[model samples]
Target: MSETNKDDRAALLAEAAGPATELPPGWLEVVSMDMDAQGVARKSDGKVVFIDGALPTEWVSANTHRKKNNWEAASLMAIHRESAQRVRPGCPHFGLHSGACGGCKMQHLHVGAQVAVKQRVLEDNLWHLGKVKAETILRPIEGPAWGYRYRARLSVRYVPKKGEVLVGFHERKSRYIADMQTCKILPPHVDAMLMPLRALIGGLQARDTCPQIELACGDTVTALVLRHLEPLSEGDLARLRAFAAEHGVQWWLQPKGPDTVHLLDADGAEQLAYGLPDFGITMPFKPTDFTQVNSHINRVLVTRALRLLDAGKAERVIDWFCGLGNFTLPIATQAREVLGIEGSEALVARSRENYEKNQAQRPVQQALAATSFVARNLFEMTPEMLVADGVADKWLVDPPREGAFALSKALADLHQARLGAEGAPPLPAGAAHWVPPQRIVYVSCNPATLARDAGLLVHQAGYRCVAAGVVNMFPHTAHVESMAVFERA
Candidate 1:
């Protein structure tokens, strides 16, 4: 081809590929952390750059791997100056090093500083997103930083070329599974099983068919649910049974979806349970059920939430989004009557079963007899539905990441309806009269949605943000669990 034609072709290719700006050279000082926990810095020309493995107030050199019009995504190459909060990561598999695991993010940060950053994240979300502030900032609830994770979904891969089976979390920024020998976040006993588990899988006839393993740990028992893409051979089954006996763990198998999970030793399976010794309650749950990852922090969180609720003996409390009666049973111990409401009928049934199991093992106390569970579509709750339930003296809401938007809106709507017109007459006889609870304790896993709901409660429902605090349920990760207390103004 001619030189002119070659030049024209190169220009065409460049245009089609979009902007190919080269990464700016030299080091940059990280100014702050973004919402996703990535360190934020700026290029010489003022374009924002996000760097992983870099902390705020640290000078680092990074290479721009992904470039956009206004920002770039980079990976830390070298650190010139590190922040005081920086510390050696507890897990050897942490950071951007080769064969690093992606299970944890903030392990390099001091444990105390991690909580402070989380508190700041919560406060910032409340003020910026909700336009509300708490009257008091409750001290952060913390627990054992390591060996606290009671649940995990570990990836499984059998690589014939590598001549081994890898069983653990995925590699950082990659789909490949990390070859982890031990995990620091898991319980010590469970962590010790990592290498053995890899060997067990390698020995299985259907090792290539197993894609993942789900771990759930209770107070007395640990269960492992293996996800098999294909049918397991009889030999594979025997191997699993042998491994379970050797490791003292219950083995479950999942052939398809979560609903298809079943115990291998159904007749001899031990009950998986967790205890709330403070409330004299024990909760039994299935391996696939949703439960808190950190039992220690969960207990502390429950205690704090109950304290903030301050339910009296004569008060009737309602627990919203009550899954397996975690908070309901505890509150039932103090309140006159506790009503637990959940969106899933299965969960409601499980809650009732748990309540009965706990009651059967203990004395017939007044609080135990007054507890009840109901199934309701919480996301679709309206003011009318809430009013029909009568007035609750106190409320405990533990909602998922979507937050309690509908519930908060319903309360706001009820408040507005009660106000009505200035000269409005009394309602007709027998009409359902709604009353707001004196206090509400909200547990949230997502700050954005919590702030949104908090705004409604404070501005529209005539409630004040009395106090709010963070719960470090997952210490080394960016998952911010929190609780807030709202009181009638």
Candidate 2:
């Protein structure tokens, strides 16, 4: 080879490799963790780098996968100094590798540290977004670390090229299904069914039609809702029945939307219900209804919320965004009158039925307090509507990820009106008689939204953020479920 030819080869190699400085030089110190469980570090140029599979206080190098002017997203390449809070991930399918499961993000971090990180996230969100701080930081509520997921939505895909069916969560940041044979977060029995489920679906005539399976486990019964686009044949139905019998699971089929969900065989199936033993309350729900994924944490959460709300026998309480009367009925056991409000009429109707069902089982001495269910779009609340609903002594607010913005805003409006603040909205017709609830216990799923609503309550509504804390509802995942207590000043 000539000298000129060698020089050309060297140039070609350099071009193929792109930039020699693709990876960040030296070790980066992870100072904190973002909401998604990614480690936050600063590069030499002062740009932020979000590194996956890295923990706080750890020195590491990362391989950049995405880059921008202000930040770079990278994966942990090497750990020069590992943090004591790091631990081996429990799940075989959890990793930064290709086709890893997206179900969990904090499996590598110690479970105790995971809860601490979530608490910091809540605190950061409150201070940064709401510009409010809680007077007291409540103790973090923790529960069973593993086998706690009582509900899951497993995606099903038939791969003709592989001649197999995949049943699991999506791959990390990809729509492709993860090749998961077992899951650590799921109940052992449910986890054991993964391989069998794949085999069952792969063998079915309607394998190509079935797209998803939603699992919901009650105290006495486990239900699986199968979503199928095409009609199943008699053979496929029999197979489902046989599988249900073998696994002691109930099968619910959904031909289209959630409304179309029905039991495959209702004659001998156990009623799906979870019991709040402390309150002696049993909640019966359909497979499609919105129920907590972690039953244990939910029961504890309800108990803690009621304890914090402290609705007395003489006081009237309202449960906002109440679905299935989870809190209203329990509150009715103590309060003079309790109202359960929800946006969906169907949910309100079901909540009424649940109230009736619970009443039938109660003894004469243990009778429930007066309770009523009403359908209302809480997101469109106004001060006038608040006055019309009458005054409640206490409230239990458990909104979804959107949080209770309008309700908070309504209270803020009423406060400003009473103060005669400039530019405040006009008071409603019955504003004089409308006394705001003395206390509110808010259950939130999103910290950012919670902080926004908290701002309205603390700064504008003349309420003190008494206490707040994190609820480890979904362990191993980056989800942050929390609760906050506010009291009128």
Candidate 3:
């Protein structure tokens, strides 16, 4: 090794082995990191310490703020040694300081390093929680590090004390909104509107009643949804119209739940939509619908997911928890038939509408395969329901944070029944001809729940984890989005 490299390594070792009396009282060497982006260390007695704003391989002094029997939560006080991956955060509102925005966590770490940590977290969750290891680790999917957030819900509060409206994310661990003027994570156009939005909200009579502003950006249009507890006066409505006209953005108002969201001026307002050009499909959705926050990554994700699924032209495919037919329609373009199932009838209807819209747009010579949508409470799935749905050649399971626990468990129960295990549920009548999908591609936003369902699939359902990898859907954040492919053994 070079003399300079040797000296640096020796310095780090010396710092780590320094006497307890020489360093700060709570000095500890961060050994690893957790899913929440906290640095993990242990006291001499083996008591675990979770320190915020610290990274693995860094030695920092921490102040314990919350303690339990087994672990203590602390904040970084001083760093005696720094990690090479540490970087200056681009956003002024991002930090551990008081009143900082809670929109992101890993901004201080290098973007590549952030993705690596998330990849490690996915691997650890799969092995430690599910005890299932993938046969191959796919390359991580990456996109732009900034200006990638096509969706965001900004909190608005009229802080009477400051005599101004506060608009942005909530303060870290605080209900009060952060005092941010601009955000780097949002699309550049949306980021430019942050201050203007505050001014616009501040000028309204319902400013105090208005609680949130949600942004959804498409290829050519940006839609903002304002959540107001009370009705807007005529003057306020006029002001909103003027602002929308001036900003080149459409305005949607929500007086109640997501179902009540509608455009302020529907006439001549462009429809909100995103396109997956790979499949020549454009999906129209309301701002309140559960669309992926990162549109660019979502497109790449869909492409990768469909590639991994490898549905044959003559094969049938099933999309569980399909919202707006994002995957179902794409699969329909390639497969013989596609069945989309979701819990909400409203979403199912929308999915069907999207399927028809795409079909109408397609050339007469190039028609999509048969596609259908159904609403069923996936959380209450059973072997009987599985038999009724019939078997598909492949499954695309993209569930919410809760994951497809019930669906996975049902499959496991069916396998047990096939084995004639004691106390196992008897096969539903006419299920003697039932068969499970040959392959399943699971897209997950929560790694823990994915691990749990993966355990059920691998250990109980007679399937093997073929390949898995992390998707950098939300960069500079602790959120780990992943996809795994499972094949029947």
Model 2: per-residue Cα lDDT over 1-489, one tens digit each: 233432332333334332333235667888778777888777655566778999998889889987765567789999988999999899999999999999999999999999999999899789867998999999989999999999999999999999999999999989999999999999999999999999999999999999999999999899999999999999999999999989999999999999999999988678999999889999999988889999999999999999999999999999999999888888988889998899999999999999999999999888889899889999999999898889999999999999999999999999999999999988989798789999999999999899999999999999999999999999999999999999999
Q: Considering summed lDDT, which 10 consecutive residues are worst modelled in model 1?
A: 1-10
Error of 2 at 263 (Å): 0.4
- Give the higher-lDDT candidate: 1 or 3: 3
* Ranking 1 against 2 by lDDT, winner: 2
In candidate 1, which residue ranges exceed 4 Å CA deviation?
A: 1-26, 43-47, 365-369, 421-432
Q: How close is candidate 2 to the true structure, as a TM-score?
A: 0.94
Q: What is the lDDT of residue 257 in candidate 1?
A: 96
Clashing residue pairs in candidate 3 (N, C-alpha, C atoms within 3 angstroms): none
Give the per-residue lDDT digits (tens) of candidate 3, residues 93-156: 9999989999999998999999889988898778767999999999999999999999998999
Per-residue lDDT of 85 in model 3: 93
Model 3, CA-based lDDT = 0.89
Tens digits of lDDT, candidate 1, 416-488? 6567835433433333455689999999998878999999999888999999999999988878889999999
Poorest lDDT segment (10 consecutive residues) of candidate 3: 1-10
